[model samples]
Target chain A: MGETPPRSANAGTGGIRVAPGHGQPAGASARVAEAPVSTRTPGGGDLGGGGGLPRARAFGAERAFRGLTLAAGTAVLVIIAAIAVFLIAKAVPALRANTANFWTYEGWSPNDTAPEFGIGTLAFGTVLSSALALLIAVPVALGIALYLSHYAPRRLGTALGFLIDLLAAVPSVVFGLWGRDIFVNPVRDFSVWLNTYFGWIPIFGGDGPFGKSIMLGSLVLAIMVLPIITSLSREVFLQTPTANEEAALALGATRWEMIRTAVLPYGRPGIIAAVMLGLGRALGETIALAMTLGITFGISFNLIENGGNTIAANIANAFGEANDTGRGALIASGLVLFTITLIVNITARAIIYRRREFTESAA
Target chain B: MAKRVDASNVTAYYGAFKAIENINLTVEPKTVTALIGPSGCGKSTFLRSINRMHEVLPGARVEGDLTIDGQNIYDRDVDVTAVRRMIGMVFQRPNPFPTMSIYENVVAGLRLNGVRKKSILDEAAENSLRSANLWDEVKGRLGKPGAGLSGGQQQRLCIARTIAVEPQVVLMDEPCSALDPISTLAIEDLMFQLKDKFTIIIVTHNMQQAARVSDRTAFFSIEKTGDPGRLIEYDNTQKIFSNPSHKKTEDYITGRFG
Candidate 1:
């Protein structure tokens, strides 16, 4: 090839200067000066001053930050594993010492010389109460969430949303006290009314003693978890994309139709997650359920009868007076509660993953 | 079915702030009309007003008359949903319902209108997709999520969804602004094919697109920021591009000023 003029000089002469203050000063100018040598030589490291630029650090603060986050994430799994190990280690010895069958026996007398205790009553009551609570709470929570996100004016929605969040911040112990001291009155009268008119229904068949029953405990549980589901569902509903909502509106959808088409579908997975979280809270709830549920030993479907018990509530009520074997028995029950919650969470994740295509695409 | 659109002395506002004022334009049936303007010039606001979608936003409202085929759409007794059904809109971004399948997105309007027969929905889905020039690419994937499509395909899917209900008028607001050049050409071609069945109104920032696809062009501009936008010139595309009467229109078309 014939001798070629320098490329930067030729390029500088060809184009108009668009950016003001165009030329580089000092070291940057020197770097630009060596560009043509590298191109012309077509060899590595041919340009002068090319190696003068400082190499980036072999390790940076980002590595430390990443390690910190990784450790934080792993710490959660480690703690969970530790809890499982402790529960199992504590529980096996008690199960061996127990005179009664752990799963099927209804009575709990673990402190006795021939300790006879089982999770049958506690398991039945826990499932029945939490399920009933969700049945009552989910619809009401969804209704409140939709009202807050869609029907309320901007200022009203924000105010109401703040109030709902504050509702969530109230301690569960306060709910327990209110359920026992104050709220039980109306529930007793309502239970009497139910027993009077609807006594034919098995659940309401019980007479006279109606206060502090499964009905009361479930009602208290519903109120306790209501704010959790409502706030989370409202947030999810509010996050429905404006583009999706507008697309529905522009397609001739009525207000309800718009919500059904866009808001509800887009918020489905999030709402499911919210409901599952609420269910988890209701399942593991201790003090409030302990105070409200009448502590009885048998499994019964009579909701208005003064009889119900749950694993967490039993644990709380019996923990103070428990012996070593008694404590181990309680730990075993706690293990059962832990397993139930794990199964519930895993089921929720499976449901979410089943619709992974839609959720992922939406994200 | 095609319908003529008439807007007279229309003013739209966001709360107290007017976005567009005194927008007077006539769009003939079975023709393509383009609204061209700079950003913040209320071209989108005017297009949204045609279908009452402008007022969907909080504190937004519209005043004055908008008629489709000589019937005022904003009358007190008129159902808003009916007005929207008659005048369908395709948004700037392609928004196929994220949770819906391709077939469901196309038939979403029909389902809203209470059409429930399986055979009817299937036929309508196919026809609408074909009209939007997307049937061949998507027929096999009707069960797939509508959001899984490419950007260009999604826009086309949105077009199909809009037209499936067979609105008399279709409003497009910068439909090709988010697409690549090849995709833009596909949409422009689709717009041409669509003009035979529906009255089309499009808002665009691309001057050449307006010149190429529209029979008539309307130029909108604002005096300054925070001021309401006004119509500068409304004329035949050829005349407006070649010899605009207004100085502002000429300057805008010739790249002198926006």
Candidate 2:
């Protein structure tokens, strides 16, 4: 019998060869001959493998599994690095050809002979619109999340949570179309009402032609991000330990007070992560902003004005008529958007990490 | 500051399933009363009902009469928060708020009741920690997270937090079940001191623990699986342990049956 040789061979074979008589002609003989030998070895003896169990082979399977998973884990970093390299490579040429200061010039004319464009207005618009959207969405999202997780009956919470998740699944294109054809009118009227009354507030102080303005764009963005924040926050809230909540209740806390003391603090990191995820969604949204926003280009704090444009919206609006230099300029803006999101994500992670000691001790 | 707790024909249920049926016990002010029973025997359930904490679960409820110092806690208009405030509880597992510092956790109950003065909170925190026998160990690190303490110390911190609000009655649900023997001894000693200021009700699986610390003992048992728990005997700790009248209580105390 090929006993000793098979033991060494089986070390890397992950026990598949030990399936009695599957494909190997010597399978039964190999098993019978290896039983006594396996019981003498340290690893096999631990499993009491005198009955011809494939102990060495099983050990090999675990190592093989770990190697496979390691590769899968590394693939994500590799792919992200590849994307950053591609973006930088494509963006440099158009940046050199530009006749304007890329960081400070507010106007974009990449298609002209001496292409002149800057990220300044686009960057400001992106940050302003997304910040406004978050301001409008976070409180409402948190309210809905708290209601779903703590206040509603279990069955009702499940059903309503499912509906909110469905809203998240609705395609961005559909949200864009709804903003253009259905939701824009009410937003326009509301914008006019704000201008009529609170015009002193610079954000709400734009004149007529306010239908397709930054206000409309941001409101649409707010609606788009609301479900994302709500669902994520609800999950985090639901995970708050029942023990902590009970401790609060036992200490004479009202229901809301229990939430304030137990649920909110425990879920703070998770909530911040959710908000960042929503912000990421708001920042990257393109078709929705393109369709909803008035496509004028200048920095203005008057949100109801028809003159705000974000990087993503610019890329969508410009890509169609773009020359090679024009394409590079759009990709360059995309790189900037990517960097911004990267910074937002890193900051969120840092906040979560700083609180790791408390969370870990909690577990 | 202690107040008497009276439960008459109190029945608790989880949705349609009855947990404990018609439990009647009176705990005297400033005394340590212990509930002893086997697993699934409703000792913890009965303990929770005393502070109205039983109803915190989604489908859990209590019926019949329960009173604290002649006030019916189950009255329709009685504020549940006030009931809990008057009757504080310590759970089986130590649950110091993970996000709060030691000082903050001790004053959490006070803060909830709208106490914002730092001097008041500091005094309360120090006083409560001292009473719990934890001040000497934790005084230097009051700013540290409460969860950073050892298991025994965390349990003590939880005790401090519970009593910081100066509740009249304190309910402890197997407070030492998770601790080592030394930690258990420390908490048991704290229970003796705590009985001087608050009415304390404790539930324990360790028969010896009930004998050692309780002024009075109540035994709970169920006939079989799925049956609601019933009180078999309640008497002075010495009488219950040495000369229990009920056969079931004797059998349980003597290790004949669970």
Candidate 3:
């Protein structure tokens, strides 16, 4: 079997010689001789060739599976790189054509001859609105999450969890329409009430016409982001180890005390990640803000006044009638938004990574 | 300070399934009592019921009287947290809080009891660690995460945490099953020392372990599968091992049958 010359000769003549010897006990020997010859020829062998053919086929399949998964992983990176390159290529010409400093100027008029525009006010509005939204949403979301994970009966918790997931699936345009129509009157009255009693504070000190303002936009954004944060944090809280909870109880902790000691500490990183994800959604939200905000073009800390704008809402509002420079400017603003989201995600990842040593060893 | 444990006509259940039936035992203060049994025999269940820890699971409950120093723990008006505080438990698996430092782990019980002064916390942490026989190995690394320790050290840290509040009783549920031989020996030695200050009740599958460490041994077994476990024999460890009165106890100790 080890001689190459004899094997080659046998491969050519063995099939023909084995075909006529089926009548005697020598038939078994003849079939074995033909089997090795046929199996050695790769794809030409039948599955009846047994061990070697199936094993070789399985090896080929394993290699093909690995290659497919590798390609899938690389596709995501390729798409991200392509987007960044295209955004930069389109943004450079718009920046070069502008007569005003892109970072400091407060007005936006990219359709004019000089195309003087800047993102200073837009960036400010975007950050302030999202931060305010987070302030309103985070506490409520954590309360709901804790109730769902630890306090509610199992059936009710499951039902409430499903309802929260459904909330996340609602269209943003519907939220915009609802905020502009039904929610605006109550918010206007509340703003008037605030300005009456506590107008000394900068954010609450607006003069008049408090119906469409930054506060309204932030409230709408908070409503939109609440379900996402609640669901994700609930998942994290539910994953607290039973052993750790038992340890706390055996140490004489009350129910709330057990949660404070065991559940909250274990869910810290997850809560941070969930909050950052909600912040990302709030920052990039457009239709809801466009409908709810006054869409002014200046930097002001008055949250209850009728004037605010963000990078994404500006892009959506201006992109309809924009010329070449205007479109490029909008794309440039999109690139800035993209960069902000990227920074937020990377910071969240760094926070998680810094604590991996503790979490992993415990696992 | 140690407290005597008295159980009369105690039975436990998980929803509709009876786990242990009609157990009666008295454990003297400052003595080690070992509960030996086969798998699914409800020895651990009985031990958890002593501290009212069994009811933490949904639908799990116990019936009859379990008393500590003549006060019934199962009385309708008794506070469960106070019961657990007076009777501490160490689990089979060593579960030190993964998020806390070694010093924080030791002081966790005290913190739960609302001890806020830093000097008091520091003193309790040191004393508990020393009593658990872990201070010498961990004194230099009090700031390190509790999970960074070896398995045996983590178990000892859990012991220290349990004792920090000065509980009158301590329960161990196969505390050395997940440990190596050397760690097992160290825990056994610590148990001998701990018997001076706290009432200790332990559940074990290892017969030799029960014989070696316990003052009194209770043998638990079941009639058949799906039946509740019963106390087959209760005697001094020497009498139970050397000359058992019941045939089933003799058979289990000699390794003839579970």
Which candidate has the highest DockQ of all?
Answer: 2
Tens-digit lDDT string for candidate 1 (A1-363): 022347766677665342221332233346547765322223222334553433322444456878999999999999989988999999999999999899999999999999999998998999999999999999999999999999989889899989888988889999999999999999999999999999999999976588899999999999989999999999999999999999999999998999999999999999999999999999999999999999999989999988899999999999999999999999999989988888999999999899999987897
Estimate TM-scores for all models.
0.89, 0.90, 0.90
lDDT by residue (A63-171, candidate 3, tens digit) is 6878999999999999999988998999999999999999999989999999999999999999999999999999999999999999999999999999999999999
Can you write out model 1's per-residue Cα lDDT over B1-258, one digit (the tens) per residue?
999999999999999999999999999999999999889999999999999999998899999999998999988999999999999999899999999999999999999999999999999999999999999999899999999898999999999999999999999999998999998999999999999999999999999999999999999999999999999999999999999999999989889887
TM-score of chain A of each: 0.84, 0.84, 0.85
Give the better candidate number (1 or 3) by TM-score.
3
TM-score chain B for all models: 0.99, 0.99, 0.99
Worst 10-residue lDDT window for candidate 1 chain A reads: A18-27
Candidate 3's C-alpha runs over 4 A off are A1-59
Q: How many clashes in each candidate?
A: 0, 0, 0
- CA lDDT, every prediction? 0.92, 0.90, 0.91
The DockQ of predicted model 2 stands at 0.58
Fnat, one value per model: 0.82, 0.77, 0.66
lDDT of 2 by residue, A1-363 (tens): 236568877775866554432432344345446765543244433233344443334333457889999999999999999988888888999999999999999899999999999999999999999999999999999999999999999999999999998988888889889988888889888888999999988878866778788888889899899999999999999999999999999988999999999999998988998999999999999999999888877888888867689999999999999999999999999999988999989988998999888877666
